[model samples]
Target: MKIATPNDRLKQIMKERNLRQVDVVKMSEYYQRELGVKLTKSNISQYVKGTSNPDNKKIQLLAKTLKVSEGWLSGYDVKKELVVSKSELSNHFDKIFQSDKIKLDLDFANQKYENQEHKLTFLALLENFDKLEEDKRKNLLHYSDVLLESTYQKDEYNIVATMFDNSMEPTYSEGDRLMVSFGFDFKFGEDYLIEYKEDILIRRLFFENYKILLVPLNDKHPTTTIILPLKDHFKVIGKIIGKIKTSP
Candidate 1:
């Protein structure tokens, strides 16, 4: 459909596309009620004679029926190109990935092992998943004590984690994730991802005055904070330096 006499352009599109005037009515009502109308003549003439003119909305509807742009119907679509091939899309994707860098986001304590090996090794952790029986989660607590015995300072626990639970919402939402560094400097209002009571995995952590508070990301959810009284057993295991969400 072009901006010539509406009758002439309508006839031209009908001839070129093997479409009937009634087909235009049907197409105009796409995904809508069926239209039953005569089509011998006077279809496009109603608009051409200035007896009636389509508003912007009707023009858009008519253009959609003709598989053309509303701009084309109004004589403005001539400058636009509307189609692109799959190869063009592939080329576009290639251009962006060419400069994308994949870096290892490791904990500050593990900064000594920043090379690609860390990524490979960290991913190796996944291989052990299947071997970790469901009931073994509690047993893993034993490993924590043994792992903590190393006393390598915060720098040695080179891993970061985010709490995985819906206990926090809105403020922390169920899926809101965070990044943590074992050596992350404490800030008054900032939160930390950490473990409480060896079993409670939670997300909100803040420092006020001299007390460290493991607040829930969402106050609406159940949350509690423990004050460190210089007891290693009652301490933050890791700083939630980052999060990789697996589900909502």
Candidate 2:
């Protein structure tokens, strides 16, 4: 009744699971560059031959990437995914990755799959804009973060959107939230919310030849809200793509 060693367990799992060497190799492809230069089939064969052992970091990623307990590799996983985000907190994770995050009261999550490709993560938007402050009749320039130079183009992307008591009511009312596409230069087909001389407007942009149009929602009251076209009196503050509403 003796306990099996880590390597012993590794050999056992490989055999019982009927896993091929290439199976492990293909898993490693996820971080081929970070773990080291891209590994070829020949390199994988070398590790199987015992003539070469993967580097420490490489081995950890290899084991985790393949869902094999690290114990099966470095003799023990009594350890973890060894996360180290670049200072930017922006360049570390991939387009999609399984890693970690500090959320609410959870002490530690075994895994947190991060998706970077999402223009703006839905959860992030929800958390930032759950409630609104009084005296603020508009959302423009509120939670907005201007991007002067980002890899993606779509200026003024909405990170947080809310809908309640807004001129956009009936169509957009209480308890609605939206995900926005942002960071492209101002143009038509793009709906922007701008404040002119401190007056706020949530409207769509339409350019017809030499004229421009800024149309608002709920026009039953009509001219009470002035409708203008390319007036020298205003500037483009921002655009509204989507919004979410919470209890007023």
Candidate 3:
């Protein structure tokens, strides 16, 4: 028995897809245009030969182009398919609704509302509800619940989102449910969920004179700094008030 390496997975997928090294290089160009990352013929050759491994960004691009899971491509023993079953999605949402932290009224659809805006929104959703696909309807209902919870809840922390990376390891691991409050008043030494360019990151904040530093708890990741005047693309989505740990 032998352990599978990324090289093995890469070769396996290439063979399955009937793709050549040149084909991969050409296909990667399409993703590079959008991701602004380069993957050359040499990079692909080295990856297949086990001479080198692809970095995180390249791994993502490769996964998307090759149509496989990042974990699987990285040689992890996981499902190759990225698709989630309808039952699994339903179970995930059920956990959210059943959580004690959330107080979303499930019967809002039947209850009468005095607010004209709320009434109109619910009416519109009801009118077009049947036209939407099953998955879209579920997403719309979840969005509506979150929106209502944020609007009516007295607490500052109204939104709930899952942490997707290990950048905040020890303090917050991946799959942890983060209770985030929407605000722009950034306090130093606090953890925040921020939108930097196209990526959402969870980082601890530190102010140094005229610069704002985004520091990760995991020292493997380097700290990012932004000057006092934030760029148009940079935005602080919210402060992380609390987190529900999913793993021990």
Candidate 4:
């Protein structure tokens, strides 16, 4: 009997839910924002196309978010209702991989860092963040033991995202880099990074009884006052706290 692979099972589940690729992308982002797990579009494509597999932690989260059992999702055993442990998954990857060169390189780098007296500087790589796959990146970081710089101090819940449009001109310009804080207190007539209808926008939020209004500051831009159901289509990603204007 031919048993289904994890990829096959994922496709089946997605099919059952009538989910598209873009829907999966949204689900992955939702998972990351709520759970701190990075699941990108690349990761979803890889998983569905059999190019890669998620770790046990990701596997569990995937099952929970997709409304499936771990065993069924991974195609381990149809009757077994269990989740694979992290250690077991790590051991599985190690055994399956033919080359250990990447692992060896990481080990050597770790030793060098341990013996060095210089302070290590860590900066968030801002380029192409939307294009990165969370699961693959997490696995690489785990395997390499890379430690990211802490943002727990004043910048806690803060992220830097570049603005590509001039919709909020005078307040925000094209090519400006914004320092967005996810922990900001929401208020009426405030500019925010909003998620609406599966699109990300930087606009002003207005209060209404049954609907919320997304208004642009620039009148010349001709943005229609988008009236959306208060809680359904509107999501606040973060508030724009600061900006770094690019020199013309």
lDDT (CA) for every model shown?
A: 0.43, 0.43, 0.67, 0.57
**How many times do residue backbones clash in model 2?**
14
Ranked candidates (lDDT, high to low):
3, 4, 1, 2
Candidate 4 per-residue C-alpha lDDT over 1-248 given as tens digits, one digit per residue, 9 for 90 to 100? 22767788888877755667656654454345446687777888898888887888777667755645777877766642234454653453343231122333344556555543522311122223224487654544433111121222233334444444457887776434466676788898888877676556788888676556688878776543555434357668788786632111
Ten contiguous residues with the weakest lDDT in model 4 = 144-153
At residue 71, candidate 4 shows an lDDT of 77
Give candidate 3's TM-score: 0.47
Best-to-worst ranking by TM-score? 3, 4, 1, 2
Q: How close is candidate 2 to the true structure, as a TM-score?
A: 0.29
- Residue-level lDDT tens digits of model 3 in 89-203: 4454454543322233323554655567587666654554556687655544543224423443445564565555567888876445577776547689999877776556789
Query: In candidate 4, residue 120 scores what lDDT?
Result: 39
Those runs of model 2 whose alpha carbons end farther than 4 Å from true positions after fitting are: 1-158, 161-166, 174-182, 185-187, 221-233, 245-248
Poorly placed runs, candidate 3 (over 4 Å): 1-131, 139-156, 183-185, 245-248
Q: For candidate 2, write residues 1-248 as lDDT tens digits.
A: 22544444445545644456665454355455345546566655666556666666655666644445465556553532233234322222111011111111011211332445542454454333334343231222221212111123433343333232235555554223333444547777556655444444455667666556666566642322334453456766455655422111
| Per-model C-alpha RMSD | 23.0, 22.2, 14.6, 16.8
Predicted candidate 1 versus true structure: per-residue lDDT over 1-248, tens digit per residue: 35454444445556654555555564444212212223222545565445656556555556545545456566542632223344553442233222111112223315655677666675554444435575453333222211222232332334323223345554343323333355656654555544344343555566666666656655555645555564544545445543322221
For every model shown, what is its TM-score relative to the native structure?
0.30, 0.29, 0.47, 0.36
Cand. 3 Cα-lDDT: 0.67
Query: Which candidate number maximizes lDDT?
Result: 3
